[model samples]
Target: MCGKPTARPGRGRPPVYCSRSCQARAYRRRRQPLPAPGSPPAPRPTDVRARQRRRIAEAVWRIAAEQGLDAASMRRIAAEARVSLRVVQYHFDSKHALMVDALRLLHEENERLAQGRIPYDMTEPGALLRAVLDEFLPLDEQRAFALRVFTAYYARSLTDPVLAEVFLAAEQPLERLVADIIGVGEAAGSTAPGIDRVHEADLLVSGAVGLGLDVLHGRRSLADVRTVLEYHLGRIFPDAIPTSRPNPA
Candidate 1:
């Protein structure tokens, strides 16, 4: 007998398989013998749950950015992901959990971008700062969408303790990285003396966040934001030699 349990009675013969597919699979297996012990195992199937979760998270981010965080409900996310509502619920217990997961995904993406862009050598602090800060700028459609979602989530975190904890935890690594860069520059004599490394890092990060919001809201163009960021970097690393500025177009 097939192992799967049968459904409740429906005034018909009791079912031996859950469905036609299962019945056919059992028949095929019965007709074939198992492979030899030394034979290589079958390849593992792709992880559907992980794939579904990622799909759902990406959908949530797009909806949050385009329509605001409040619009990113489980039902809406399911619709956007082209999955059933039940599938979304199966992946996440609630909307809050989905949001937290989506935020984590966004943070991971930001970290990837930062790691890829930041130079291995920290001797050039001005260039290093520019590279690090550029990761947060909304210079393209993808970055702009990410910024919008991050800002929306951050604003929500102000009133939600759980989100606040998650957000603050995610921020720690970037702050530490910035501080370390500043320290390295100071050691190399490329940064201004007597600078409060931690405070400067905080200010730099806060400035980037503000500038990203401004660009998202069209308060300033990306080029203008880049110029402002360059000016701020100059102030922080006054001793560092200036590099040729890029054309702001």
Candidate 2:
């Protein structure tokens, strides 16, 4: 006599397949396609990290944007990612480490967006200046959020020396890049006559920070920031005037 089929353990439903043999028999009956041997196995998607890290980063940014940096704590971030807090902590050693990573990610994203769009040749004048302006202006949602998070961290850093050190270190590359661009514009005769490269770089960084703060505080809308940048660009690098040499007078 054949053995009777038993009900499944959890839901109390009859087993679809009585045993391993039954499963194999059913599967064999269903035709399945097999790929050609040398066809590279469908290339196995290259975006695994992109999917995971992007999800994590999106959650981090969303938390940062909506709740501010403190709200982006490990547990909060993990909850946002729908993962265990330990998982978030495992990936990043601490809140400071995570913040550093977030900032670095934001920096990379901005660089990617600004690359090639910014001209390499300073001799071109307006084009190079526009590139510098483009980086400072938060023209869209992504840029806006990045700048917002950056500004938050920057503010937090004022009292936290560790955070400040990290923030300033991250900003050094950008400052250097700005200095180089200013130097080029000055050399190319595209900047204002009396503009000091170091001084101007300082002013531009301050202005960018101010613009970001204004947008963050509702003092100015994103569109207003854009307009302000346009106005400043025109004043800073007027097409009619030649770049002025530093005067001894």
Candidate 3:
């Protein structure tokens, strides 16, 4: 007999094997017993603090994106994560700490996605420049959310020293990377003659940031931003300018 209990009185034909699926499962189990529950369930794999931290950080990111970073309080984040308030506090001592962690997570994820999109060869300085700068543009939902959070934090950093330090520290590496790429372009003669690579890098980065904000605010579209970037790149690398004529079919 199947393990299921019989239904009372006239419910049905005592429900043999629960259903066709259960009947099949019982037949299979009877043929070969299950592999003895693997050493008392192997310690149950607890959620651990790392997972909690990631969950809390993601909750903060979502809340910050949907309703400004101002709304990402410990209580709100805890509620969003379906965990107790103490859990959030346990992982992050302060709201600023939580925000910083969230920002770091978002930055890491964006960087991974951007790096995946880049090509291995760096021969075309113009193409490399476009690829690098294009990483900052909010052309999709994930990038848009990242841009929003960055802009929000940047605004806050203007008035808060701690956040200002964090923002500047996070930006330094990117500035250096862009400057290096521009230096490569200049060396290859793809960039304009005698151009200040560092200053040009700063200009490109600042422009991308500002343009990203504009796209997020609806003042400019992704296409518009790409057009501007193309024009800007052409100015630095004349050979990179795209033709105006449409390709023939």
Candidate 4:
């Protein structure tokens, strides 16, 4: 009867495994890699190659934002993105290359957004001035964050010549746009007759960069910053503003 199907002692509590190996097998199946206390959860493993490359880039940006550029290493970025060191290296050949790509991506995105917001043509001197100057302010949340990221990258570029080159590449379109505006101002006879166009164009770029940085750092309000920019524009194009009452803001 016992061999046929008799109930064993402690069967009410639980059935004993037939052998220790079975129990060991069950425990092994249950084991998993657990995150340590206070550790962040890991990213999922699906489509890991494409996803981890993007994640590593974003992690580099976040680390740069929080801890500064010196701390944003390829290994650290891979850890933050929760990918293997080989993955980040696979995506980018080296740490400097990774940083260069990341900064280039950021610069390209910023230019795209800024370009999208411009509605004025270079032929329209006054309108072009307003459009170019508009980008120098944090008119909305996206622009505000973009300005922050731009300033961060610009500061990092001081120590990274390759990054500086990438940044200048990104700025070429805007510089050309400025040159076009200066040409319009010259054709319209609005700009000072004696002013050197090339020098003035360079000055305008420097003014835009400096004024934007000042406003970003809270050294001046947007209204005050606009006034300063208009002052520079007026110097460049004395006749651009009509003598009649300007439009209300």
The candidate maximizing lDDT is 1
lDDT of 4 at 129: 69
Q: Of models 1 and 4, which has the larger TM-score?
A: 1
Q: Write the per-residue lDDT of candidate 1 for residues 1-249, one digit (tens) a residue.
A: 457676968698877877554665566568667778999975443476578789999999989888889998778999999998766776676789889989998888877876876786766767887778887888667788888888889889999998898888998877788888888888887777678889989988988978878877888888888878888778778865554756544
Give every collision pair in model 1.
none
Q: How does residue 217 of candidate 3 score in lDDT?
A: 88
Residue 18, model 3: lDDT of: 52
Candidate 1 has its poorest 10 consecutive residues by lDDT at 240-249
Quote the lDDT for 153 in model 1.
Answer: 93
lDDT of 4 at 14: 42
Residue 54, candidate 1: how far off, in angstroms? 0.2
Once fitted onto the true fold, the runs of candidate 2 whose alpha carbons sit more than 4 angstroms away are 1-54, 221-228, 240-249
- RMSD from true fold, candidate 1: 7.0
How many residue pairs clash (N, CA or C atoms closer than 3 angstroms) in each of the candidate models, in the order given?
0, 1, 0, 0
Q: Once model 4 is optimally superposed onto the true structure by TM-score, how far is the C-alpha of residue 103 displaced, in angstroms? A: 0.8
The whole-model lDDT of each prediction reads 0.81, 0.66, 0.76, 0.71
Model 1 residue runs over 4 Å out of place are 1-46, 239-249
Give each model a TM-score: 0.78, 0.66, 0.75, 0.66
Q: 77-196 in candidate 2: lDDT tens per residue? A: 888988766545545656777776776677677678777467677566555655666566565577678877777677788988876776677667766676677777778687778877
Error of 2 at 96 (Å): 3.4
Q: Model 2, 70: alpha-carbon shift in Å?
A: 2.1
